[model samples]
Target: MYRTPALLAPLALALAASAFAAGEHDHAHEHQPLHGGVVVEVKDVDYELVARPAAVQLHLRDHGKPADVSQASARLTLLTGTDKQEAVLRPAGGKLEAAGSFRLAPGTKAVVVVTRPGKPAATARFTLK
Candidate 1:
């Protein structure tokens, strides 16, 4: 009886350890953001502002698939000289584009938030002058 109990003790400990590991792994996956259907290429993103035209243009290229940008929507909040401006983005020519009517001066910061129809939302940071 002593030998049997000792053998079972190790098996019980192993089972407990395995259960704890699996639970931790499951929790990690649960908290991860699921990037919807769009695969964003962060390195290819560019932002340009035309102060005279009072417009800001966002350029994004998706080499993955044509449908990636089609269903994506974007919103931008620009911080310019202590003032904030918001712009709505629309799908245009394989990219999600946003144009602001307010003239963006140099040293402006912009935060772009994009949401895809079925995928996880993503954000991009840019500067405008």
Candidate 2:
């Protein structure tokens, strides 16, 4: 039986649109910082960095829920103009914490390298304005 193009066009379009939406939904998520930090997503995981004047915090989440980072460690390197600083982050409670005064200023940049058990290392970059 022959079908009219007008009848088939919408059906085909709907199928295509739905497939695209489903694929996108499964691959990426909207990023919102839960801890007043800059949020970055890497392979469906979210990393939030809250760089304070005297402390540094790194929060992790997967799919909007707090991620288990008990076995994870991160190294944060801060860059502000010609001055540079680095800190080792140990898992403290839900976030990785480090104690020290970071000379954070406007236009500062941070590069974090996170290592989790049995997973490849992930790196995220953030900038403070």
- In order, candidate lDDTs are 0.57, 0.90
lDDT for each residue of candidate 2 in 57-105, tens digit (9 for 90 to 100): 9999888889888999999999999999999999999999889989998
Candidate 2 steric clashes: 0
Off by over 4 Å in 1: 1-52, 63-67
TM-score of 1: 0.52
Candidate 2's displacement at residue 103, Å, is: 0.5
Candidate 2's TM-score reads 0.78
Q: What's model 2's lDDT at 14?
A: 99
Per lDDT, the best of the predicted structures is 2
Residue pair clashes in candidate 1:
35-120, 36-119, 36-120, 37-119
> Which regions of candidate 2 are displaced past 4 Å?
1-29
Candidate 1 versus truth, CA RMSD in Å, comes to 10.6
Worst 10 residues of 2 by lDDT: 21-30
Give the distance in Å from residue 38's predicted Cα in candidate 1 to where it truly belongs. 21
